[model samples]
Target: MNIVKSVLRATATTATALALLAGPCALPATAQTPARPAALAAAQQAKRPNVIVILVDDMGFSDIGPYGSEIPTPNLDALAANGLRFTQFYNSARCSPSRASLLTGLYPHEAGMGGLDSIVRPGLGGFQGRLADRAVTIAEVLKPAGYFTGMAGKWHVGAQHGTPPKAVGFDRSMFQKGGTYFPDQPGKGRTFVTIDGRQARLDSPEVGKGEWYASDMLVDWTVRFVDEAKVAGKPFFLYLPFTAVHFPVMAPADEIAKFKGKYMAGWDQLRRDRFERQKKTGLIAADATLPDVLPEAYDWDKLPAADKERFDTIMAVYAAAISRMDKAIGTLVADLKARGEFDNTLILFMSDNGGNAESGPDGRTGAAPWGGKYSNIFVGLNWATLQNTPFRYFKHYAEEGGIATPLIASWPAGIDAKVRGTMVREPGHLVDVMPTLAELAGAKYPARFDGHDIRPMSGRSFAGAFDGKPLTRSVPIFWEHEGNKAVRDGKWKLVAQFGAPWQLYDMSTDRTETRDLAAAHPDIAARMTQQWNDWAAKSFVDPWPNKVDGGVIKGRLEGGKAPGKGKHGKGKRKRAAQAAAGA
Candidate 1:
């Protein structure tokens, strides 16, 4: 393991040589990345790549330029242009579970995070509200194999279960349960983060007063960690999970200005535009059909002019949030290049889940300078339906719209040139990240860690996909959250909404799941349902309505406020929502 760092540091001389070969202005002016010199590329590739896994919150499949969005994500677009874009990547349908899966290379149930971390059902083993002790994180696997592990941003997996990031494996970390974009925003409680194991204000003097943005803060810490890794002379494994494009959504005014009034065309047209773009960019199958706008989505044409204006402004904020994150990414990429680590860094960008429509179909947007819980804007079903273009349902469902996520990987020295700027049609899940990093970093997935028998990884390494090979997954992918269950077995997908019977789709032909084949092919549906049930039972998944706390726990879809709540109860629900959003 120690020898790996030595080889990497020695290989740095080759990167330096290449830099000297180029003039003072080393970076290209255009969007196209320059070709790497053969010798230098070989030298860097021989050593371990600096691994970065970037997860964004509540973003949809087509929310970025590389995917299908009109919103400018120049940095992300550049990465996709220079590397690989995956068309069929999927995430667990919610936040905490997805993070658990991404870190541990296991299904959410196996990682002990089947529900939101805020929902703690004591004695109900699978829904423990945190990561399982037996699961090992990518950081844990990589650190012992000569990597400096660091993390910045939301760490929603409960600290009570498997401890926080620093204790798990990260050498340095700064994280909170949820997002509080502006620390100084009045009436909104500040989110104190655990930094290097110490609790501190998220907005320190280093971040200038009244200038604390969560995305920038995350990137600043990432850059600092990278510099620290350089001093330690080790390859770095940095996890940056940004809390952007999520509820309580906010962005800089100037950024919001850039897209104000731009969404007047509304969800209907924007979704169609994105769908067309997806087909044109080869991010979706050319013959693929777009599913109709969700039934819950508002009719843009029916909305009053004032409502249209309000909707446009809020969507602008959503766009601003994404574009701002993109700008921060550009900064990170530039810093990597300045250190001559850009080519050797394997950067992976993905979303935790699909678009959120938590506040309801109509959505809600509060007054300026959002301070309290539920006080910020939610794009709601209308805009969220657009965000997950050509798909059905929003977040919290076991549908393509909820689970689908765009995954982009960039490694100038590692990815094959033949696949650059091309879309990969192979289906992948968040679980694959750990194994991929383990393979690229030459790290071993241990059988035992900290005297506990570790859970075997459910994911296989998709590193071959980087070289333009197929991601030949042997087993089917499964999902279950709040009673929404699904199984993706090759071309067939069996999905069921909470309290609903299974609906099957042929993913090879109808990736958007517009057509239900279950009635026509009942045999396939029954077989897959059996497979899912068998897997779920063995994987610690409690059946819906299972006993918990000595009572029958009825299913509460979306985990929102109870029904029949009047105005006062509505206020309480909002407060609860605020707490949950931050939690």
Candidate 2:
């Protein structure tokens, strides 16, 4: 066995490991447990633990303290200190697609979301820009199993497509389109909050006046929903997807002040610092090597003092956003403990995608917070590189930096004591969430529901990992977004940029994907590509549209709603350099 695996296994006793691994670990198929009788389900619900899935937007693998960042995330760090952390967990690499896959146990395309909900393509089921009716959400399945489901925060999956959280199965929800953090902050689009199922005020007294923060308000409603569940005497399933750390990143002035001057060392030094910390934490393999910085990142020493100072404030704001979210999580965990639900409630925290690099190297900024044109404020490619740490690329690509997410699972009663504080090296994805919850909650996954033929889940349960056992994936994992495509089978990964030839890498040896082995291993590349193509066809993945405009293209192309003064190509770089010279 590999040293890392052996170390992980050693966390548990020989007897415990043997007994758990040898026990019956079969996950129930849809046909096997179609529906439990109402009485039986009610009785089982008493014994079932509450489940809470907390997802953050556009966060990187190393942003939180557990994943090796300087950012203060004592709440998340505390969870990992007493819980299990997966070293290799993945997301769908974007917002809508990832949300769709996470809610339903199918690929984004299979769930009728191949891209952002903002983009729609006619006659294409995959590009329908909505969550498909054929796929059932976790809330939908768990509700029938006697679980009281509630959601708070962003619900971008199918709100525009006429399927809100309440429509899908959440008993209660408080959600919006999720752009602004402060209630008074002006955004280009009007984001209205929906209470339960009806349209409601975004700036309600519940959120307060000037003190209203999105993260705080979201959790307040979550606590309210949990109170309702406790009153009903049903096991709860709560989903809290915060819009923190995404573009137009904002936090309280004092919070932002606390992080000012913390990132003055620049991206080069910060990236190295995070990489070393990640290796020391055993989050990556011992032999893993960091790749060189991308050409898009500017040299820190060469930058003007004014630009550096500005960048520092921008990063401080970014870090403040994460710190604020972490604080909110602390509040939620404390609430759970106070309610006597912390021990049994399985809290799974993760990100929707990797760090966002949408607005180019010098990210867009402006008076959007006070009511100017909505400026998409991001940390730029250089800072995003540091955020992703040892991984290459950022959000909107199939690379590790794009999809790799930090997944922390904590359940004092449900998880084995021996595995606590240990790292699970099992590679898992968002699809696995459904089956994992199903097995843990003893929920029956139905073949059909609500007069519709529901698609069978494409996920395998990773619940065995709670006992320090391997969560073996029988099939390969695949990704396709914005023309970027990739397929990973066992140790081999074949990936390609939009309109580019495939490049293969042996993931077992190089998870960072620095060296391409396509020329040396043609057979493996061909085989995996074929496998990806087959899966894509079945999953309703549409062909590349070959269209580009004022939208996200592929690779190094910088496109978003906040283009700022930076365009693409030499002109963008030239302008940035000229501005730096003036600065």
Candidate 3:
């Protein structure tokens, strides 16, 4: 078994490689940032524990109950209340990139996912639609180590060349390329089922053709996969990434009804309520200030009165989808508990990126028919901004709201009860997931995998944090999606919009990123900026856009507002107006 190396021990080797990065700056180690204790109990309890990673798409930082949402996610909350919560966990600000980073213990670009695959161009080293042969996935690594690796849910990593879940590493895989969550609703995506590398039919009644919800089918099949692993007496690594809460937004009518009037108060009140709950739950600092609306964002009351009911319905569908996902999770957990597998399993819950503000192309481009068809309705910017409560901006930007995500790690036999329900504020990224799981499974990441050379992992495990020990990551975390980019070094973060000037923040105090310290602390800004540029070059990050006026969101140089619209005007009325017209 190749034990995962500690961050402290890898520093010297990484320093030489990243000294200049692709340029010259060395990070100083201050008193260790908060760390997790060693999970000695879980490691020693048995040969290898079952590893399950549950990923949700387009979810905001505070959308779940454990993360301070008004949404009643009892199962998710119970897992968190009995496990660990990461206060500063981050995603890649978009879907496929985030998934790439999570699957491979390397930066997204290094894994050939510089941006969404839809727009990928040939010869673009970073935007290649497939996972590079040089990068080995966690499944690929663990499968060789006496493990049955399986995956069920969204597979957005690659399209051709066996890039599907089973092709990469899973032994028994079920997934769709990417699509709406309501399976019964007709949409533009296809669902494929594969077992032991052979195709399985989803059209059969067993898979639920007439009344299938994505979340329900996922957990149901996953339970069966676990049962197979248990019967064989082999440890399993299951990666379940759900398509819940994405868009076109559909859920069971009863579940939707439960939250029908719940959001009548409007986004402003919802943001305030969530912020208050965050403080009460110790998720954020008690004195943490709430953020003002983004320049393009508008007030809920400002929405046309005629459109109020429709918007409310959209939000209801969203909330209901969340609750439904939680219920399915509860069912999956119950199965584990019933089979006597709950105590020794390590389950992780996280989001692919922040909440989406896209109202589609024309605000109502993909409206869902009341008769149960696949819908592509964008929730628009108002409620999305509210979902990111206390943080500014939404998905597709490098701001805290776009990247921050709720991460819950639960393992009764692995994590110490004393540290359960506790918060770890150390900065971590999705790249850390692969290494962490490999460490727990005692699986070695090889230099060469599957007839090709493998890339070295750019992540460090936080297993020690489970024991309540202070930890320091070997390298700072970096992010880039579209044109939004950020580099977090210790307490300072340098963030930039596509084709915009870089803005610096002292995250130790202003995690909301309300203040720009670039001018005040030019020295820190320069050093971090150099590091960002170097990383961009090394990670295949695209060059800055030519001509400053081409970038999105102007006037951000001084303050955050878009143009004439005040921070709280809601958003450009064109989309909402179109949505109202049912265009």
lDDT on C-alpha atoms for all candidate structures: 0.76, 0.77, 0.72
Model 1, range 1-583, lDDT digits (tens) per residue? 1334224423532343354334221111111112223423343347779988999999988899998999999999999999998888899988988999999988988988888776667777678777776787888777766778999988888764545786667888888656567766534435466777678765666433557677877888898899999999989999999979777788888788889889999788988899899888777889999886543345677665876787798789889999999999999999999999999999999998888766554556777643223357777666887899878876666798889998999999888899899888877898888877766665557776654688877866677777776667778889987777899988889999766789999999999898999999999999999999998988878766621212111112122423213321111122111112322
Q: Which stretches of candidate 1 lie over 4 Å from their true place?
A: 1-45, 160-162, 186-189, 206-210, 369-375, 546-583
TM-score for each of the candidates: 0.85, 0.87, 0.86
Off by over 4 Å in 2: 1-27, 30-46, 207-210, 368-376, 547-583
Question: What is the lDDT, from 0 to 100, of the residue 222 in candidate 1?
Answer: 94
lDDT of 1: 0.76
The TM-score, computed over Cα atoms with residue i paired to residue i, of candidate 3 is 0.86
Please give, for residues 25-134, the per-residue lDDT of candidate 3 as tens digits.
Answer: 21111122222223423453456678899999888999999888999999999998889999999988888888899999778888888766554566777877778767
Decoy 1 TM-score against native: 0.85
Candidate maximizing TM-score: 2
